[model samples]
Target chain A: MTVGLTHFLILGTILFSLGLYTVFAKRSAIAILMGIELMLNAVNVNLIAFNRYVAPESHIGQIFSVFVIVVAAAEVAVGLALVISIYRDRISTNVDDLDWLKW
Target chain B: MNFSLLSSEMLAAGLGTGLLILGLIAPKTENRRGFGYITAFGLLAVLVATFFQYGINQSTFHELWIVDDYSVFMKQVFIVAAILVVLSAVDFVETLPRFRGEFFALIVYALLGMMVMASANDLITIYVGLELMTITFFVLVAYQLGDGRSSEAGIKYLILGSVSSAVLLYGMSILYGLTGTTTIPEMLTKLTWSPILVVAIVMLIGGFGFKISLVPFHMWSPDIYEGAPTPITAFLAVASKAAGFAVMVRVFLLGLPLEGAVDWMLLISLLAGITMVIGNVVAIPQTNIKRMLAYSSVAQAGYMIAGLMSMDAPGVKGILFYSMIYVVANVGAFTVATLVRRALDTDTIADYAGLGQRQPLLASTLTICLLSLAGIPPLSGFVGKFYIFQAVMDKGILWPAFVGFVMSMISVYYYLNVALYMWRDDPKDDRPVPVPGPAKLVIVLSLVVTVVLGVYPGPLGELATMAAKSLF
Candidate 1:
C-alpha cells in the first residue's frame, strides 16, 4: 500500500503526542529538551510528507527540513548546556524547582 | 529566487566564522578590541553593499528570499543599528570575566538571522530565521550565567519562548493546510478565513508578540533585558524586535489577500492600546532604570503596531520611520544607563540623584535621551511619535489615537523622574568622573542626529514611503 499524506500525518501525530507527553511528564530539563527534539522531528516528518503529496514535484519542504535538523541540533546543545549548569548550581534537574520567581 | 545572497548575510556569516576561529587561536591577553573593530568593518561593508543592491528594481532568490526597496531599507537600518551597538560595547564586554569570541559570533549570527528575516518571503524561511535569532538570544542573555539573575532570565525566556515557537509552528501547519503553500505570494492569492486559519492568525500574533514584547505576552522582557548585557539588550530592543515586525508586516500585507484583515487590524489596535497603557503606567513605579526602559520599549512598540495596523501609505511608512528613530533613542538610553551603572554601581533611579552636579556631560546626555524617549519636541522620539500619530489619524482611528495620546502623557511622569534625578542638584553622593571619549562620542553623535532628524525628517520620511511601496 502506498503511504499517503494521512499516513505520514498519523506518524507525525504519534511523534507529536509523545513529545507533548515528554514535556509534561519529564522532570529532567534535558528530558524536556528531548521532547522538543521529538516535536521538531515530527515537524520534519510533516514537511517531507507535504513535499511528497502537495508539491510532489519540488523538494522545498525537504530542504527546509534539513535546515530544521541543523537548527534543532544547535538548540539541543545550548539547552543542554544551560540545563547542566542549572543542575550544577541548584543540584536538581527537576523542572518544578525553577519556580524561584513565582511570586 | 536566487540573486547573490545579501551582503549582510555574507559579512555577518564571515564575521561569525572568524570570531569562532580567533576565539580558538588568539592568546587570552591579546587586544580583543580587534574583534570588535573587525565586526564593525564587516557591518559597514554590508551597509555599502545594501545601497549598491538597491539599484536593482527587484531581486528574488529561490522564491523564498526577495530583495526590493523594503528589505534593502530595513537591511540598512539593522546594520547601522548593529554597528553602533557593537562599537559601544567595547569596554562593557571587555569587563566580563569569561569573555570569549563566541559572544561576538553569536551577535553576528543573530544579525544574520535578522537580515534573513527581513528579506524572507517564505514562511519556512521566516521560521528558520526567527529560531536562529531566538536561540542565539537564549545564549546571549545568559552569557554571565554564574549570576543568579542571568540564569533566571534565561530560564524565563526559554520557557515562554519555547511555547511561543510551538504555537507559531502549529500556525504554520494550519497555513499550509489552508493554502497548500508556504510561499508568501502564493498564500496571498490563496488565503481563506476558515476557523483554522483565523486561529492561526492568533497563534502567529502570539509568537511575534513575544518577540516584540507587546502586551499580554511581554512578561519575559523586563527580566531578560535587565539580566542580559546592555549591548544585547539594545540589540533585542531594536534589531531583533524590528526583525519580528518585518515578518509581521509581510505576512499580514504581502502574504495574504487582505481577507480577515479588518479583524486582525482591530485586534492589533486593541493590543496597541493595552500595550501603551500598561507599559507607561507600570514603568512609573519601577526603580530599576533598565526595567523601566524595558517597559517603555513595550510602549514604543505599541506605537509601531498602531502604524502597521493603519495599513495606508503613511501608516506603513510611519512604522519604518519610527523604527529608525527608536534605534537611536533606545541605544542612547541604554548607553547612558551603562555609563551610570559604571559610576554608581547600581541601576536604581536613586543612584541618578545629583548626576548633573557630579558629571554634567553624562547627566545632560542622559537627559536628552530621556526627553527624546518621552516624545518631547525637537528630539527624534518626538518625531517618531508624531509620525505614528499622523498615521493613526490618517487611518481615522480616533479611539486608538486618543489612547496613544493619553499614554504618552502618562509616560512623561516616569521619564521626567529620570530627568529630575539627573539635573537636580541634590548631591546624594560625592563627585563624578570624566566620561570616556568613545562613550561621549556615542552620546554626542546620537544626540546631534536626534535633533537633525526631528527638525528635518523629510528625507528619511521619503525613504520610508518608498520602502513601504515596495511591499506591493
Candidate 2:
C-alpha cells in the first residue's frame, strides 16, 4: 500500500475532471464553487505527493499546498457571501437563469 | 528589505492599511473623505520613493526578488496609475459611503502584488504575488454584491479563475518535480522540456492566459469588468493589465526560455491577430460602457501579445511601450466614462447623445481618448500601435500585421461612434457635460500626456527600450 507518482497524478486528473464536470453540469453557483474547491484540493494532493515522493528534500510543495488552502478558504468565504446576496436579489443561484445581460 | 527605510511601496501599503483603520473608525468626514487624499498622497510618495529605490537593490530579500530597470519601470506605471485612479476615485468613493477606505486599501494590496511580481525571480514568489492580487480582487469584483450582475461576474471570475490557478499550480509542481526547484531562473536554465516540464509550461501559460484574458480564458473579463465598482474597473483595465504584461514578459522570456521555436511564434502570432480582431469587432455592438471597455481591454491585450510574438528585444520594447500607452488611454477613457456617467446620471450610449453640446471639455476629452484608443495618429495609442507594427514588420509577420492593421481600422468605426453619438443629438440632453474641477484636472493631464507621448515619444520609447534590453 504505497502511493506512487502515477497514483498521485491519476488522483489529480480525476479531481480535475470532476471539477470540470461540476463546472459544466451544475447550474447552481454554489455547486460550481465546490467543484473549484475540489480542483484546488486535487492540486494540493499532487503537490504534497510530489513533495513526499519526488522531492522530499525541499518543503516548498507543502508550503504551496498551504497557500492553496488559505486562498481557497478566502475564495469560498467571499464566494458564498456573493451567492447569498445574488440569491437575495435574483431569488436563485442558477447560473443559466441569472442572465440579465444578452445580445 | 531595508528595515530602516522600507521601499515606498511597502510604506504606501502600511499607510493604506492605517487609512483603512481610520475609515472604519470614522466613516463620515465633514466635507470630503480624508482617506482619499491620504491614499492619493501616500501613493504619490510611494511613486517617488519607488523610483529612487528601484535600481538601488539588484538582488534583495535573499535574491527571491530582483529589482532592476524592468521592475522599476513597471512600478512607475502602477504608481502613476494608482495616483490617477485615486484622484478620480475620490468623487466616486465619497458617494458610496460604505467602504471607501477598504477600497483604497485593497488597491494598495493589489499594488503590493504587482510589486512582488515585478521583482519576483522565482515561480513560487510569482505565484504568491499573483494570488495576493487575485484574492483582493475576488472581493473587489463582487464589492457590489447587491447588484446581480456584479455578483454573477464575481462568481464567474472566481470559478474560472480558480480553475486556471489550479492548472497553473499543477504546472508549477510538475516543473519543480522535474527541475527540482521552483526558482524561475534555475528552471529556465535547467529545463529541457521533458513531458512533465512541457505539461507544466502549458499549464503555466494557461493560467497567464486567463489573467491576461487571452481568448478562451477571456470570458470572465467583460463580465467582471462590468460588475466591479468603477474605480476597481479602472484598476483592472490599467493596473492589473500592466501587471499581467510585466509577468508575461518575464516568465515567457526569462523564466520559460521557449527559444528558437517558430511554431510557438506562429501560434502566438495567430492568437494575437484573432484576439485583436474579435475583441474590437465584437465590442461594436455593446451598449454598456463598462462592458465596452472590457472588450476594448481584451483587444488591447491582444496587441501586447503581438509584441511578445515578435520575440526580439524590439518586440519586448513594443510590449512595454504598448503597455505604457495603454495605461494612459484606458485609465483616461474610464475616468471620463465615470465622470460623464456621474454627471448625466446614466450609463447608456443613448444618454451620451448630446454630450458634445453639453460639456465641451468632457466631450472633447472623451473624443481625444477614443481617438487615441482607435489608434489615430498623434495620440499615444497610435505610437503604441506603430511600435508594435514596426516590431512585426521587423519580424516579417505579414499576415498577422495585416490583420492587426485591418482590425485597427474596424475599431475606428465603433470608437468613433462614441463621438458620433455625443454630437448627433438624441434629444437626451441639453444639460451639457458637467466638468468638475478634479475631473477636469485629470482629463487635462491625461490628454496632454496622451498627445505628448504620441508626438514625441522618444523619451518614453527610450525607457521601454531599456526595459526591453534588460528583460530580453
Candidate 3:
C-alpha cells in the first residue's frame, strides 16, 4: 500500500478525467477554465512523479512542470479577460450563450 | 553556442518589443499606419537574416534549438505569410478604434513563435513555442472590441486551444517517462513500442489534429475563422497550420519509430482521406466566404497530409513546396475577402455579384486564387497537388491520393461558384471597390508568385528537395 509511481499515475489520470468531465459538463465559461487548470495540474503531477521515480538524476520533468504552470497562468489570464469581455457584451458567461457564430 | 544562429529569432522578437515601445512613446495624435509598414519591413529583414542561416546544419542550447535547411525553409514561409498579412491588414487595422499599433506587435510576436516552433528540437521547446503562438492568436482573434462574435471566437479558441495543449503536454510527459529524455533526436534512439507508447502517440495525434483542424477536431475552426478579424483569419489559415505541419513532420517522422511496431501510415492515411472528403463536401454549401475558406483550407491540409504518407524526402519536399504555394494563394484569396468585407461590410458569397464589373482586379485575383486552390492547371495549387499525390503514389498508397484528387475536383465546384457570381451576376451596388496600394501590391504579388511557381517550380522544387534531404 506504499505510494509509488503507480499510485501517483492513477491519481493523475483520475484528476485529468475529472477535469475533462468538468470541461464537457460545465456550462459556465469560468468553470471550464477551472477544469483546464485542473487538467494542467494533473499533468504537473504526472511530470513530478515520473521525474522522481523514472529519471531521478535529471530535472527535465520538474522544469517542464514549472514551465507548464507559468503557461497555464498566462492562459487563465487571457481566458478570464475574454470571459469578462463576453460578460460585458451579453451579461452572461454561459458557453451556450456564445452562439453568435454558428458551430 | 554560436549566437548568430539565433539572429532571425532575435530580430523578430526585438521588432515585436520595439513596436510595443513605439506605441507607448508615440503621440496619440500620430497615425498608427506606420506600425504595419514597420512590422512588415522588420519581418522582411528577419526573413533575409534567416536566409543567411540557410545550409547551416547545427543545434545548440543542449539540443533544444536546431537550425537546418528544413527549419530555414519553414521560417521563410512563416515570415512571408506574416509580411503579407501585415500589409493586407494595414487598411483593416486603420479601421479599428484603438490598440492599432498593438495589432502589428502581436502579429510579430506570433511570427516569432512560429519561427521558434520551426527550429525547436526538444519537446519542451516545441510546447513553449506552440503556446506563444496560440496565446498571441487568442488576443489577436478577440481584438475587435465592438464585435461580440470576435470575443466569442476568442473564448472558444482559448478553451479548445488550452485543452489541446494539455493533451499534447500529457503525451510529452508520458514520452519523457518512457524514454527518459525530451530531446526529439534522443527520444528517437530510445523509443520502443509499448501499450503506453501507443496511448502517448494517440494523445499526440489528437492534440496536433486539433491544431491542424483535421475533420473530427475541426469543428472549432470554421466558427473561429468566421468571427476573427479577416487578416488574422488569413494568418490562422496559412501560417499557423503550416507551423503545425512542420512540427508534425519533425515529431512523428523523426521522434517515433514509424518504421517498426506501428502502422502509422495506415492511421494517417485514414485521417487524411476522411479529412479531405469531409472538408471539401462540407464547404460546398457555405454562403459565408470566410467559413468557406476555412473548410477549403482544412481540405488543403488534408492534401498536405497525403504527402506525409511516404515519410521520405520526396514526401517532405512535396509538403514544403505546397506550403509555400499555399501561403501565396490563401493570402491572396483572404486579402480579396478582407477588401470585400471592408467595402460592403459583409462576407457573403451572393453579395459578391458583379464584382467583376465593379472591381475587376479583385474579382480576377480572387478567381485566380480560388482556381489555384481548386488545383487548376497553370496555377501553383495544381503543381502542389501534383507533387503531393505523386509522392503518395510513389509510396504505393493509392487510396489517400485518389481521395485527395477527387476532393480537389469537388472543391472546384464551390470555388468556381464564387467566380461565377463575381463575373455573371448583376451588381448589388454600383460603387467601385477601392483597392489600397498595399492590398493591390499583395494581390499582384500573389498572382505573380502563383503563376511563376506553377510555370516553373524547378528552383523552389530544388530548394525543397534540399531542405527535405537535410531532415534525413
Tell me which of candidates 2 and 3 scores higher on TM-score: 3
- Please identify which of the two predictions, 1 or 3, would achieve the higher lDDT against the true structure: 3
- The sequence of per-residue lDDT tens digits that candidate 3 reaches over residues B110-225 is 98888899999999999999999999999999999988999999999999999999888889989998988899999988887788988888788888888889887899899999
True-vs-predicted CA distance for residue B409, candidate 2, Å: 1.0
Candidate 1's error at A5, in angstroms? 5.1
Q: Count the backbone clashes (under 3 Å) in each candidate.
A: 6, 3, 0
Please state the Cα-based DockQ of model 2 relative to the true two-chain complex: 0.61
Q: TM-scores for all candidates?
A: 0.93, 0.94, 0.99
Per-candidate fnat, comma-separated: 0.11, 0.56, 0.74
For residue B62, model 2's alpha carbon misses the true position, in angstroms, by: 4.3
* Best by the lDDT measure: 3
Q: How does model 2 fare in lDDT?
A: 0.78
Whole-model lDDT, candidate 1? Answer: 0.79
True lDDT of residue B102, candidate 1 = 70
Worst 10 contiguous positions by lDDT, candidate 3 chain B: B258-267
lDDT of 2 by residue, B162-231 (tens): 7788778777777777766767777677767455555666677688878888776788788788777777
Task: Provide the DockQ value for model 3.
Answer: 0.85
Candidate 3 has what TM-score?
0.99
lDDT of each: 0.79, 0.78, 0.92
Candidate 3, residue B50: Cα displacement in angstroms equals 0.8
